[model samples]
Target chain A: MREFVPPSTRFVDLPDGFAMHRGGTLHGARIAYETLGRLNAARDNVILILTGLSADAHSASHADDPSPGWWEAMLGPGKPIDTNSWYVVCINSLGSCKGSTGPASVNPRTGERYRLDFPSLCIEDIADAAASTVHALGFERLACVIGTSMGGMSALSLLARHPGIARTHINVSGAVHALPFSIAFRSLQREAIRRDPHWNRGHYDAESYPRHGMLTARKLGMITYRSPREWEDRFGRARTERGLRTTDEPFAPDFEVESFLESHAHRFLRGFDPNSYLYLSYCMDQFDLGESCGSTTGEALSRMDLEKALVIGVETDILFPLRQQHDIAAGLSSGGTDVQFLPVDSPQGHDAFLSDPDRFGPPISKFLSVG
Target chain B: MREFVPPSTRFVDLPDGFAMHRGGTLHGARIAYETLGRLNAARDNVILILTGLSADAHSASHADDPSPGWWEAMLGPGKPIDTNSWYVVCINSLGSCKGSTGPASVNPRTGERYRLDFPSLCIEDIADAAASTVHALGFERLACVIGTSMGGMSALSLLARHPGIARTHINVSGAVHALPFSIAFRSLQREAIRRDPHWNRGHYDAESYPRHGMLTARKLGMITYRSPREWEDRFGRARTERGLRTTDEPFAPDFEVESFLESHAHRFLRGFDPNSYLYLSYCMDQFDLGESCGSTTGEALSRMDLEKALVIGVETDILFPLRQQHDIAAGLSSGGTDVQFLPVDSPQGHDAFLSDPDRFGPPISKFLSVG
Candidate 1:
């Protein structure tokens, strides 16, 4: 019910009466972000980092916040995305509970949480917000725009909607549009959240939150994010010493993998707002870059005027399969963009970008280091 | 919480105090089954069919039942199993709700529904009950034992535990043991059912069934049952006209895939007993063919004494991937049993045996016809 914003998070106010892609307008809406490294005199060294669902603006620890970030391994002084050379600006997604104006945020006009009353969100709106943040920072163009997971979708939207916003792009486990399988997984997650009686049509307060529903939704999300191969190697029929048991429940988390999911779900429960989660998830499902431009996905990709691009996909990603990354690469290649499509055989599935930085970092670092 | 048995279903009672694999016993317990053809005078010309978690004994329609059964396409007189030549007996899994003495059944000792009191069920227990059913029907051995999905695990158990129970075996989308991925999936499903407030620790009755939990569990099952490739071809990003909406919920089933899962989940909700479902799903996760015989999976598989075996796997099956089938075939082959590993490139995934009969039928028919 409450947003979990990092201490270092800063804000960029959108223009008054900012219109949403699917309709309605926001007054005094702002995007949350955090900056690392210093901008050059010309501002051409700026690297705009867009994030996936469930991430905040704190991509890494900086002077303002010493806490380790979600991408601490991949974004540091000498990491893949070397902060020393580039002025990195990571933006929290618009419809996220993490320091962003989402369903959890107070509606300025009504002075209440937006909840279900929040406007229908789209990937384009998220893209527009990120663009606005970049412009507000006085950067006409970014040296590179990096997007991972849902951020990949937003990155595509950013490039397609606002051509030349970035000189180069890096799409990590992203997609042009959600496949039916991905949609099915996300739809089930939303259903899990909504089906809880405590959800009370999005009216539950802090004490009466839909804990069970959110727990189930997060558990399902964990399953999809990681791959079977990684689990087989990591948890393979291993029993958990501390059983996830309640009274009279015979079927509890006996397996190590189930325990892993339970622990992760527990960590996620307090950090996110259920309503905000639903809105962002629905936005991802609705995102179709081709639909935004009224053209085929290939045509839409060909429209992006980037000087260079990098599309990285994990072979084991079930949510955004490797073929989707191939499609993006193929489309961008057709556009005469210097595109590098790196297919990583990481066993971590869709979450490889976050977990298997060794495989992900080199390609990103090499791509960013070039030109 | 009621069992939905076909009118033509028959029961074969086990001896007093039937022992379970994991410990505990079932007194006055019976196995539910239905036959498709006459038992030949030799009785050696019989095929025993074991089913997945939700299936009953009614594999096909009979004169008494009239209604079509689950495998209506492959089990009639002239169908793939060829009832004219093979007297086929399809046994409902021991822990299922369809006319079997399961969690939903009345406990003979207490004269009350067993519910969670149903002893720790295992694949070996299902196999033992199935073996007892075959023996009580006056057959020392079968022509072949066909196991599909969970039944495939049961079949492997049947063959391993009761060596020479069948002359030949067909393992369809089965595994020696569940992979961690499959366990995670089944664990979440059980969690979904148990988390339902109405579940009441498996005491939920007709009026207070855990509808939401069961719906979510069934929807997740449907997602894993079929392949992503099939959904891509069938649904893509297609929207549903009749949105699966409830009052005040914006994130309803919007995509065709979501609707498809929703419809399937709804149909299954009324048909299955949630307690029985949880018990059976747990049984699958606990099943390890090696654990039963106190050896490695390969070693245990080699212990099965059979003249021939055919392991059929679908390329797209995420639940029981193709490699598991190869492992089964290799193990059986190592035992000097004539084994054929046929990997079908079917897009229907784990449920291909039930849905994509075109790819599944020919191999089964050919395997049955030979010798």
Candidate 2:
């Protein structure tokens, strides 16, 4: 299992056309992925890593590019999913602004950026694209499928669409269905983008991006990702010395928390495409595997043919609360799947899956290693 | 104490110039207020009603307008601050857009809207204005000062500034100091306004207001004002019929919670001035009674010369958490003030002061009537 690390990135084209779950064909669709370790002779030791809304395919360092990846804490040699044993493939999601065929990608039909012309995406479409990528990699089934946040929803959708495609599923801080509070926030974030006059129907030049709207949306997302307790612990009512205003300046953020959000949101806006962010946010909110599988999570989970499942929830996650993880575990357990429900007690909230990987790693590693 | 109801809208010109806590003047300023019940010849039964960020001079129905006011449930004949027994005067705060002299008011110096040029406001400024209005009405001291949310902050500010102005204080869902989380959200909300192109440095025509930006800010405020439990009870994962999308449509809110926020936020935008909102929100975040006293609520309350006080907090309020109210009560109690802490079991969150007045009224009424 401890074979040579592959190149940092590899592209797999679904050439003839990749059929999207939402009734559209992604012609010349390509999935950009990075692999860790090596596939065994039987090609049955593969685990697919689906990332959160804002993450790319770089889950771990590779031979070609040795810089640490987004999930470097979890996916290194002898780590969780252990690059020493399991061959892990992390794909940039279908509708993301990464190397994937997303809104920023050029449409084959026209020599222009797809933008809104990219078929309306859903969680199922992301799952379908990942599944096709896995298939195209010569794997009949994955040893496990691990996803976080939006990736978790797509993972469930993957399970529902193609039974027995994955031997196990690791869902972290995700829901079977998006909650009302989250939907409301997501709707507002999308509106922020649409309302930006510079968006110009999503056809603005890449240089003159919708920074304000995207920054607002990112700040909103950042707020939801962290808990109130975390904010309090991190930044108390500590105000700046010079204050947000000088003698003649207008009002600005004087609090440290505002500074934190501004820094992170600015970083996010620089990297993300506004239209892709909108599409993916909608995809996450609109995803409901239950709707496709007889109207309930229990009904849908009953159809899931996974051998084992791991559901991890953070106590302080307001976006995807512990209740959602409980539902996932209960549904799988009722369906006779060996489901290990691990509630990570952390103040990090939803982002704990990424930030506090030490707590998440052991449980996830143990879950993935069982047969 | 039962006497005839007074007029609804009374404009008191603070023509000499109202001094701001931050060291500026509102010249030719006016205080718009409404009074209920008769001010006894002694003027001893008068009670002052301070409002949250958005409320007006009208806290309840009066002779000039028969329509039920925002707090009509808690201020009627048999209600908490019973109009039959107490002469109630609710003044629009100094920096509010409601009928008060705010950023929306015309500046006497230049004969233009004050906008950003309005004197930088703080909680004490509002308290001073309210106190001046009381003095103008010929009341040496108020029987009680009952305030909620931002009003509660103003009440505390009033106590800190002029110790014996009110005999009793009732604070509902308010804090002596704004927490970091609330400050962060408020910062983003203001940014939403500033970043909106239509805001045009706060000089946009009233008709072409920053609708989208204000809507975004309002939605953000609405989310924090309620709890996850309330949202679950209200909207769950209920999707609208015809779905969130029809054939060929752009993004729109498909969730009931989104609809709820949209309806209320739209109504809020129509009546509110953007500059006033920015000013008031900053005023709230900058309110720290501790800074004026001695670096703690305990120090501030120790100097408060009130006879009795009641502090009420809703269990689910994220904006002004129960811990804050607990701190206020503890601080006052420690300082030898007769403080009664009432913890309300409510799912309405910070807005419980307005929505769950049934629970709020009894304790408040009982406390106000004591002695």
DockQ for each numbered candidate: 0.88, 0.70
Tens digit per residue, CA lDDT, model 1, B263-333 = 89999998999989988898888888888889888888887789999999999999999999999999999
Q: Which stretches of candidate 2 lie over 4 Å from their true place?
A: A1-7, A241-249, B1-7, B240-249
* Candidate 2 per-residue C-alpha lDDT over B100-216 given as tens digits, one digit per residue, 9 for 90 to 100: 788887788999888788988998899888888888888888999988899999989888888889888899998998888788788888998888778887887766688777988
Residue-pair clashes, model 1: 0
TM-score of the A-chain for all models? 0.98, 0.95
Clashing pairs in 1: none
DockQ of 2: 0.70
Best by lDDT: 1
Measured on C-alpha atoms, candidate 2 has an lDDT of 0.84
What is candidate 2's CA lDDT for residue A156? 92
lDDT over C-alpha atoms for residue B205 of model 1 = 90
Report the C-alpha lDDT of model 1 over A143-232, residue by residue, as the tens digit.
999999999999999999999888899999999999999998898888888888888888889899999889989999998999999999
